[model samples]
Target: MDFFTAQDNARRKTGRLVVLLVLAVLALIVVTTLAIAVAFYLMGDQSTAQADLSAQGMLSALSIELVFGVAIGVLAVVVLGGLFKRSQLGRGGRAVAEALGGREINLNTRDADERRILNVVEEMAIASGTPVPSVYVLEEESINAFAAGYQTNDAVIGITRGTIRNLNRDELQGVVAHEFSHILHGDMRLNMRLISILHGILIIGFLGGMLLRSMRFRRVGGGGKRDNSGAIILALGAALMVIGYAGTFFGNLIKSAVSRQREYLADASAVQFTRNPEGIGNALVKIGSHTLGSHLQATQAAEFSHLFFGQGVRQGFSQIMATHPPVKERIKRVMPDWDGRFEATWPKQPDETDAPDSLDSDERSAAGHRFGSGAEPGTQAAVLTAASAQTAIGSMGQPDQRHLAQARATLGALPEQIRTAAHEPYAARALMHALLLSEDKATRKHQLEVLQQAAQPDVYQALMDYGPDVLKLDVALRLPLIELALPALRSLSMPQAQHFRICMERLIEADGQVSLFEWTLYQLLLNNLSEQGSGPSSLKLNDLQRECQMLLTVLAAAGQDDPDEISAALNAAESELPFSLTAIEDISDMRALSLAVERLRRLKPLHKPALLLAMARCIEHSGRILPAEAELFRAMSDILDCPMPPLLSEEA
Candidate 1:
């Protein structure tokens, strides 16, 4: 399935989860109400209780109002608990990672293992055409990893130390690819929702335990009405404890039901991504053979179990509550010809220092190479032939081996010094400022002065040092450089990041107007730095005709210089839509386009495919996808949450 279909499926799964939660809560209410009725009946006078039991049914002691009250109370606890946990996770994947005691790895780490994993993650990010996510390393010895976020922009990749230590490059790459599938398929958002909803369900048990503990501190020795009240309190606490623990059992059952099939899909996607099933298959075999297996030692393991690449926690009910498929079965699905034995051990793998910088021989010989061997950075171009445009759309969220090779090539093309600068927090800030500097001498001088005065002294100096190299970077590499710098930029302190944004604004305005590149840089930068609010995504194209026109007008104006060509492109794109579009002459005011694109970002999942196709149609109208046009197109796709891999030139 493509990105849209996968997202739609995730939405449908969420609906199923809600239905299950309702059923679970309803069951809780019936049990709790019945328990309360029995407690009250038993607490009544001995003669009266006997008479009532004889005269009416067990439930007769409970009024309809009492049952309704119990249902409302249980529902309130569950819903409120879920909402509370959701709010607590407002920072998205980072919060989840931190909650599990995973430490964020510095992008500039010199540790060989850290660097290797970072390189793998960077390649995957570029291959999949998503921003480089912050990577966190758990202290656990278990071989497992996970991707978590409400959406792509704020997503984080986390793996245990054992994962990096045990798996070789290909195996690690396969594991990372599986996690990326979660990010691309919209599973992270669903996973977050599940975490929140399940927390609510488990709240009853937490409250019950707390009540039981509170009773331990209370004195209940007086033999009068007070003694009877103590008995009732103790009974209530015990009953709640039973009901609460039952909720835990049902919650895991819900998790297992929702997570199992997705693991199979992710495993298959991993194979499709690398075209090397043995990579992931071996990783799983290694996990099965290892004594620790994939079981996490973290206290929060069970709570976030479903988010794991493998089962992160020991299952209480085995397969019935297992969040992932059995390892041997998963291996068989990925490698149908597998030799079934969980290999006790494999030959010692190469150390990180001796690892190859590229994919294995077979993977490197993919049929359709994305770039020409002789083509240099900045000059290498990708064509968007009619066939290629459709291919690019289909490739969204489904990056292949060719795309991985292209990502490696792009990373290799960057100058060593520039790459280093991009990965350092202070230098990254300097590099971004340098990229914003104008070509015009006077404008550049003014921008430098603005930075010298407003930027941190060290950052200003770093800018001066890297300025020439940044100015000399390849046009195609410029965006990739920005992608590389994001993890470092995200490392900035809030106040420093705010200052960086202010300085960047001054530099962009120093040129008197926002150029297309400047707008792209600003939008892409800010979008990654900030959090986007989640919405229903129910809006259709018909709901925002004006906004759609504005977006197409901006894109047409950016890609075409001639008025006739602009008009033609707009009309072509509009043909794919239900309505006509008119070009805005003064497309200089990018804020209008930004607003329009923001509204379009909420386009329903299935509805997005057509809108994106319309966009591709407009950009490819000139019969060639220029580097700048390609950059703008990718930016638009990124904003819309439809990651478009780097366009491959037909000439290549």
Candidate 2:
């Protein structure tokens, strides 16, 4: 899928949803005003035995001012309810998961099933070049999963217990891939908005129920007058309840319209990502065969029904209000020639003996073969031809099987200890610290001294313990390793995350000068630790000419050491742009480069592909993507919200 196009489409859908909500609110206001006016007329006119409850009579009974007052009150309640829910979800995916009683799965989990699912998620994240999202497991028995976030930076994957126990690895990968599509397509933000806005509409119903319940405890013992007052209260409460439920019915229709098609797209995306139709196709079949059939047992399941891989809640009175298409139909789309049967059982799984954490010698040998063991890591030429560069750029936000295989091999290539460390919060921080340790003896010692002073005693000890293995890591694997540690690093307390960031900055500066790799690592780590918000992609390439120049200047400098060669790279990059460019005299001014990137990130969606092409041209000027250059390029692309797959040699 074209990631930017999908994002723009999702934005348009959000606009349409807002319009529908306004219409729903207007309908509610009119209905509520009429309900109140009828009640008032009957109570005030003692001759109510013959009172007209028709629209004309009600309109006459209620003054324009009274109607306006009721409309304002209804509008206020809906808006406030929505705002309150939105504010509650401001923490993003984590809050939603917690509300569903989802426990954040420990990355270092020893349970085989948990470990298996985590592996799939990590591989997908690495393949797509996004940071590993925090995974949460719900206690539910239904076969359901969901991806949630305002943006990829804060994204999370949630799975029901039945999902892990029921599906095998490929099926699980397919399900995970489907959720990743949601994340890449900018659907999560839209889903979150849907939840909050729908909550507002549903709150009117809740208020009506509350009003009805309160009447039971109300004292109505002052005689006939009290009896009339009670009757009016009863009438108003009943009317509000009916109106509230009517609003709910309309809200479901709105959600169904907005969500159903996205579900189909996600299913197709899963197939495209894995290149194995049976993976997701069979998964749908399994959901169909199962008794629960992807139905969630959580009380709030209906609230988030639209976010699930399958319909998470019971169907509405009409199929028109179902958030996902029927299971058999979904299966047919994935597996066209099917006989329409869902097997309740699959082949039994082999008992696990070796821990996934362990890699035997043969496995290591195979991984080394895939990545080239003898050659230096980042020195491999990436994007050997123009077509290859374009292919890589086009693959952003949609990684295929080859990338998945490469991610698996990359994980296998790492030392077992480092992989283990990458999963633990404290060890992950240490690994990041060790990644910054300099190669030179004096510089390395100074970096250690900086960490020793600023970091916790335990974190410092872990770094010292594994510093050697980390330093010996292949250059290409370094960034991926950092990506693996991200989820763990994210688990760090706010104070700890702050301290970690400060320590990293101190370490990078400890060497007195920042290498290209160091700059890239610092930027990548810091960016992942914070939340990223996307803006309107209204600015064209020309609008941010200076920012574009600064960005290309830094990238060109990183790729080519010679001043003349840097200019050559810039010239090559300029050929791809609408305007000429100039290289900055102070290429080492990392601060300026950072600012330029922050600005460049705001380029219009369609304009980004061209800028990315220009970046590829600039780096390709050296005729090869050096390890440092590749790191910097990927880091910059990630900050731009474009996920660049891992760069590798042509032969690989």
Candidate 3:
């Protein structure tokens, strides 16, 4: 499913979860009321207790003062439990990862494993056409990983040390692909919501534990005033403990039911992404044979079990409460021709490096290729033909092994120094400035003056130094170049990031106009800032029609040359769209247009696909799409959570 459908499924699951939670709360209320009624009846006079035990008497007891008090307590516990958990997670996925003891990997790391994973993630990011995500390494001896974030750009990928130490390069690539699929399919957002809600549900148990502690501390033996009160307190604490533990059981059941189907989908996505079933299938096989078996040793593992690359913790309720499918079943799904037996894999030696290993004759004969070599080789030319452009547009949700190889090739094709600079935080900042430099001498001169006054001296120098080579870069490569800087840019301190943002704004405004490329770069950069949190959004599609009109107006105007061509494109795009009649005939004011696109970014996940489809129709009005126009659409799609893979010109 596309992001919209996946998001809608998540929405529906939220509703189902609410229904289940309601049933659980009702069950808790009934249990609490019964416990309270029995406590009062048994502790009261014998004659009165016998009378109260009758059926009608029991019904009457439920409406008594004590039952009402018990019912209120249950309501309070469930409400407070949910509210507290939501509050803890209000900061979003980064908070969730940190809570699980994930240490964010440095952008410039010396460790080979760390550097290898970073390179894999970067290539995946460029291939998938989104900003590189912040990566975290959990210091646990478990073969598992997870992706988390509020949206695509802010997403972070986390892996355990065990995975890095044990798996070969291809196995690591397969695991990372699985996580990237989660990022692309809107699963991360859904999973974050699941974590928050499950935590809320589990808090009832935590409160019960606190109450049990109070009971343990109290002295209830003496026939003193305090002793009598202690007896009642003990009963209440015992009741909460039972109910709270029950809530946790119910929450896991819900998590298991919702997460299992998605795991199968992600497994398929990984194979589809790498075009090598053996990579992921072998990884799973390794997990089965290795002692770890995707089992996490971290204290926080059990709580985030559903988010792992495999089952992090074994479940007691068999398949009913298992968050993932069994290992052999999952492996078989990916590699239909797999041998039923799993061979044990010895962990790599501590001294051994992760350099590419020699493949066996059979493995080598199966596919004689490398990561970005699936495609034959597209000419390193500037033009976009109709066949290639259309294929690229339609390849949004489906990226094959060829796409993976092409992605690696695309990065290789970029200038070596630029690619190297993209990896470092400081040079990355300069890379951004260099990308914004204009080809026109006067415009370039004017931008330099503004950069000198507003930008940091080192940043200005880096831009000036890289200017000529940057100018020679392909239009298709520029976005990916900007994307390459995301991880480093994310490493900026909040204050530093704010300063950077201000400087970029000054540079854009200094040009006295906003070009489409510049506006796209700024908006994309903003989205890539994890602090922004996808900005505030409205759910109603109709409310944002003016913003939609503004977006289409700009796209329509810039995409075509003649007035008739612009009008025809707009009309074609509008034919099915029930948008506002108030459309901009002249889309010249760059700042105003930038604001319009910003507003459009707030369109709900479901609302975005229609807008994108409409815009695509508008762009294709000439019966051909330029490479620049395709890039613009792809960028727009990426921001909206619809990932479009790079169009293959030849192959790789």
Alpha-carbon local distance difference test for all models: 0.83, 0.83, 0.74
- Per-residue alpha-carbon lDDT of candidate 3 for residues 372-412, written as tens digits (9 for 90 to 100): 22333221343444455456545555577766766766666
lDDT of 2 by residue, 1-652 (tens): 6877887788788899999999999888888888887778767765553566566765667788878998899889888999999889887899899888899999888877788889899989998888899999997767899998887778899998888877878899899999999988878889999999998888988988999999987765445643677777788898988888888888898988898999889889889889998999888988888877898888888889899999998895789889999999998998898899876753223353224534578878888766556665344323444444566678887778878877888888887889999999889989998988887898898888888888999999999899988887777788899899999998988889888889888998887888767877887877777865646656788988888888888888776578899999999999889999988777687887778777777776778888998999888876666666666677789988788877645754
Best by TM-score: 2
All candidates: TM-score:
0.93, 0.95, 0.88
Pairs with backbone N, CA or C atoms under 3 Å apart (clashes), candidate 3: 372-405, 375-651, 375-652, 376-651, 378-650
RMSD of each: 3.3, 2.5, 4.7
Error of 1 at 625 (Å): 1.2
- In candidate 1, residue 608 scores what lDDT? 89
Q: Which model, 2 or 3, shows the larger lDDT?
A: 2
* lDDT of residue 652 for candidate 1: 31
TM-score of 1: 0.93
What lDDT is obtained when candidate 3 is compared to the true structure?
A: 0.74
